[model samples]
Every structure is written in structure tokens, then in C-alpha cells.
Target: MVLAAASHALSYFQAVVIGLLQGVTELFPISSLGHSVVIPKLLGWDSLAKAQSQSESFYLAFLVALHVGTAIALLVYFRKEWYGIIGGFFTSIAKRRIETPDERLAWLLVVATIPAGITGLLLEHELRTVFAKPLAAAVFLMVNGLMLLAGDRYRRRAEVRELVRTHASTESETEVGRRLDTLDFKESVAVGVAQIGALFAGISRSGITMIAGLARGLDHEDAARFSFLLATPIIFGAGLIKLPDLFGHLGNGVRGQSLVGAIAAAVAAYVAVRFLMSFFETRTLWPFGIYCLAFGGLCTLLFI
Candidate 1:
């Protein structure tokens, strides 16, 4: 269905709500895509839900715009880091060697982004077609929660063992970055491969990536930082690829709504990332895990 015919279906209030949700959940390990699919259904916005399920629809275009906003927020938040990383990337190319931490990290992120980028290019449409429904999303959300819980448990155990063996204390930001920089290319590839799971509606890109990072011996804060860094390119690329939809016939009626939603998303994303960076500094993923489990379970029962 053309968005113009049903433009009124998505009111400004819904736009704001969904924008805020996208911003927050995109950063949180709670499966933003899953929530985007399920929440509309829960709210009885059948038109919006139906639009989301379609391969080419205004809702999907709107979502792409939201992703752009989220990506911008990440870019702004990590502006300093990006400046160094981008410079390091060029420097490494000029020198034909990777010696600095920023150079290594720049290369590492490239390696880690490849698998998911290729996978998304190859199978994104097929995967979304098969699993974008509320039922599938709900199931995957539960699985995501389980994965988070398992990852958290494993991290705790690993931390305890390390503490007993070496009495290491909490890691500062610099220490965390240094540790992340130490990751070999193989480990970076592993983290990247884990991101493939997020192609399914209910699996979180950040959540799965962070879990993989944790498995590679990164603490919570470091894992989160790496996940955010990795997400920046992917999110922006995806949005950029589909950005024409916002200006084409698909966006004919919803352009204004998209703009409003994008603004809300940007603001919400900045705040959410700020909060999460601080939260992860001294926290574990247990709370998010529990929240996902409970919410996913409840949604599953209600949907069924």
C-alpha cells in the first residue's frame, strides 16, 4: 500500500514514541529491531505492523531514517575517537604497517565489520521476510535474553578466576581501550561473525556483538564500546543504502513524519548512549538480560 493513502495512520505521537524506542533500544542490548516489529503489533497499529512486515514500505523507509539518526548520535558521541581512528587508518596505509593502537583498532573494526556486512548484503531481505513477524521476533527476543544471561554468567566466572589469579581490579577507560586493541584479527573476526545472528528480527546486533566481545575477554564497558564502534559503520551504511526511499515515492506522504522521527531518534540516541556508557562502567548485563527475558516472555504469551 502506498504511504500516501495511509499517511494519517501514523500520527505524530506514534512517530515520537517509536523514534524514542528505536534510539534507546538500538543502544541497549534489547533487540531494537525486534521491539520495532513487536511494539506496533502490541499497540494495535495493524497498518504500521503490516507496513513493517512488507519488503518495501514506508514504515521500513522511516526505520531506515531512524537508523541514520542513531548513527549520527554514535558519531557525535565518539567524535574524538573517530578522529584518531580515521587518521590512524590513513597513517597505517601510508606507512604500510600497523603500529599504533588506533591503527590496529581501525583495522580490527574493518575486519570485524566484513562478515556481517557481507551477510547483510546477501541475506537481509530473505531473513527479514521469514522472521519479521511478531511471533518469530518474540521467540528470538527470548533467545537473545538467554544469550545475554549466559554471557553475563560466563563473564562473572571469568572475572572471578582472573581476580583470584592476579587480583586485578576494575578497568579504567584507557585500560579497557588498550585491552581491546590487543585483540588479534582472529578474535575480531569471531566478534564480527557473531553479528550475523542479528539479521534475525529478535537478535540484537549490539547484544550479540558485546557477548562475543566479552567471550574474547573484554569487560562489560569495553565490550559495549567495541559494539558501539562496530555498529557505527554498519548502521550508517544500511541507512545510506536505503536512504533514497525517504525522498522517493515511498516517502511521498511520510516525509514530514520521518523528519520529526529522525530528530527524536537522534536526541534519544545521544542520551541513551551517554547513559549506557556510564552504566556499563560499573555494571553487568544481568539487568538487561532479565528485562529482555521477562518482556519477551510476556509478549510471546500475549501474541500467541
Candidate 2:
């Protein structure tokens, strides 16, 4: 039987708004999951929120669809990188060695993804029962702001120290930016471990991973690149895992809205990635940090 009917249909406008919100926030170091949970409550969509609270599978499957849309956007935008990684994956198997930088980077992403996969498999259901609530997610969103600020400040200090050391050394001394391919296995593992934190509703996958990258000495732009690249497989894989359940919840009435939402999510994600690739080159995460603090605080006040 159909598990349970939603009390009301999700309107097209609401679908679009939620899709845009999810897509943009997914890449922007804000928590997409947090927004999805909180926005419905804030908008007074009582039936939807009640349904979500009642049927975790329904809401989770909807989120999975949104994530799949974002993943598709990432795949299209980063097609070149994906090509290299795929080639490297096969070449390493043939050669019996991870020879190329691309191959090593590919392996590194695999290593980094392990913790999240394991953590999710073990803890996802349990955590969702507690942390997926609007009030709890809102509280964690503010905590996310603090994490961003701390990461940015740490990176700045590290950079300054590096600059001073460079100045003290010979004029011909070389400096290396921590490019994705250059990350040591241990460092990659550290980043992967950090990704476990993102399983919580308000902790952003990109935000935490990039924080770990910055902590490991990557420049802002490169950190963002690695973060986005690392995100593709996880998001896509999660969506794929949840897809069957998502379809189960769909009917003639709800399926169209879901498709519309997915398309809107794809468009928004593409724009977000394009804008952020440029923005991080010259900008810092401080603005995002501030925004999270303000927005999270407002949500907390309203919800609590």
C-alpha cells in the first residue's frame, strides 16, 4: 500500500523555492538539509512539516532527489575533472601503481569518502531521529557559523606564518599551495574524517571539508575546488541509494512537482558552483559565516 498520503500536495511554487534554496545552500557552505527542514516550519506549511515528521522516508527521499539534481549539476560543470579521475582510476589498475597526480588524487578522494560512508551507514537513522528537528537543526546552524569563522581565522594565521617563513628564507625559496593532488594520504584521511561531522543536519559537507582543506594548507580557491570535487560522488551516491524509496513515495500528483523541483535544483546548483568558483578566488568565508550566524539566530529565535 501507499505508505501514507501527504495531507496536501506540494505546490509548484513551493517546490521551486525549496529546490532553489537547497541547490544554492548545498554548495555555499550553508546547510541545505537545515534549510529544507526549517524553511517548511518557518513558512507555516504545517501539513507538510507534520508529514515529514511522521514519515522520515518521505522527506529523506525528497532530499535525495534534490541532492541528485545538485550532483548532476556538479557532474556537468566538472566534467573535465571527472574525466581525468575516471581515466586515472582505470590506468592505476592497469599499471598496478598510482603513478599520475590525477590517480593519486582520485585515490585520495576515495580515502576521504570512506569515513562518511561508514558513519552514515552506522549512525544516519539514529541521528536523524534527534537532530533532524527544526529547532535542533537551527541550533546546529549557528554552530556551523562558529566553525567557519574558526577555520578562516586558522587558515589566515597559517598563511601569515608561511609568508613570514618565506620572507626569512632565500629569495629563490619556493612555496607550494596544497593542491588536491599534493595532499598526503594522512591529510586526505583527516579531511575524510572531518566529513563525518557533516552527517548532522546543519553541518555542511562543503563547509566542513573545505575547512579541513584550509587547515591542511590549501588556498581558498583550491580548497573550494577539492571540496566540490569530493562532494560529487558522495551526493550522487547518496541520491542513488535513496532513489528507489523516493519513487515509492511518488504518484501522478506528486511526481510532477518532484521533477519541477529537481530541475530548479539543477539550475540553481549550476549557478552556485559557477559563482562560488570565482568568489573564493578573491574572497574569504567571513561573509558566509556572518550570514549563517544571522540567519541561524533568526531561525532559532522563531523556532525556539
**TM-score top scorer:** 1
User: Please, what are the lDDT tens digits per residue for candidate 2 over residues 256-301?
Assistant: 6677888999999999999999888777789888888888899999
Native-referenced Cα lDDT, model 2: 0.80
lDDT, model 2, position 28: 94
- lDDT minimum window of 10 residues, candidate 2: 167-176
Q: List the global CA lDDT of all models.
A: 0.87, 0.80
- Residue clash pairs of candidate 1: none
Model 2 ranges with Cα > 4 A deviation: 1-7, 51-57, 159-176, 249-252
Model 1 earns a TM-score of 0.94
